[model samples]
Target: MIKVKRVYDAPESDDGVRILIDRLWPRGVKKDLVDIWMKDIAPSDELRKWFNHEPEKWEEFKHKYMEELRSNPKVKVLIEVIRRSENVTFLYATKSPYNNAVVLKEYIESLLTK
Candidate 1:
């Protein structure tokens, strides 16, 4: 199974092979703070700026983000890794708790569950 965690949260054992999915290094976080920084798995700069976490644009954003993920082998590889791994956590810095990774996690889990 895959898990989601915030960077500020203390690392835990269950979050096996923690992967930081943010395109940019989280503000104020040390490079050594997290393991396996999978920056390539994150959305592109263009996509990140486009979404900007606007509630009004979330629905549209989700659609486009998922499409981008599908087209990008880097993002897809992360999902593939999680599907094959016993336990992996997607660590993101967003405070919303409803960022693209939330939806992306669900999509990854669904693929694994199948």
Candidate 2:
């Protein structure tokens, strides 16, 4: 199974292997805190800038981000690894609890789960 977690959340063995999906490391966070660092799966710099997390642009962001994810073969393999694992957690550092990781989590679940 796959789970999504935030950087500020408590890390426990039950949460599974944690992978940080941001293109850049979250500011002020320690390297040792995250388990697998998967920058390859993150949205490209151009797509990330285009989304910008503006409320008015969220729908478009979702669409574009999904497209970005779909086109990347490397990301597909990452998703496959997570699916093959007994459990894995996608850890991100966005302050808004419903931002990048949330969307990506939903997308991943849809693809990897029934």
Candidate 3:
């Protein structure tokens, strides 16, 4: 199973194999708290800057980000991790719940179902 969570949230036992999916480290979050930091799997710097968590740009951002994920080799690594673990949690720093973590979780889940 794949889950999305905030980087600031306290770690839980059920949150197996927590992976940090943001391109940059979240402010005030310590390194030890995260299990894996898949920066390469995150959206490109240009895309992230363009989105800026603007609700109006969410749809466009999802489209563009999905395009990026389609070509990203690191996505295979994420898939492998998910395959090896019973549960996986993707952690992100964004205040918006509809950010990259949500998109990534959906994308990964789609792949798993297929």
Q: Which stretches of candidate 2 lie over 4 Å from their true place?
A: none
Q: In candidate 3, what residue range of length 10 has the lowest lDDT sum?
A: 94-103
Pairs that collide, model 3: none
Candidate 2 RMSD to the correct structure: 1.8
Q: TM-score of each candidate?
A: 0.86, 0.85, 0.97
Sort all candidates by TM-score, best to worst. Answer: 3, 1, 2
Q: What digit string (tens of lDDT, one per residue) describes model 3 on residues 87-112?
A: 99999998886699989987888888
The parts of candidate 1 lying over 4 Å away from their true place are: none
The candidate that achieves the highest TM-score relative to the unseen native structure:
3
The lDDT per prediction is 0.78, 0.78, 0.91
In terms of TM-score, how similar is model 1 to the real structure? 0.86
Model 2, span 1-114: residue lDDT tens: 777878778898887777898888888888888877888778889877877777787888788788887887866777767867888888887775546677788788888666
lDDT of 3 at 78: 91
Question: Per-residue error at 86 for model 3, in Å?
Answer: 0.7
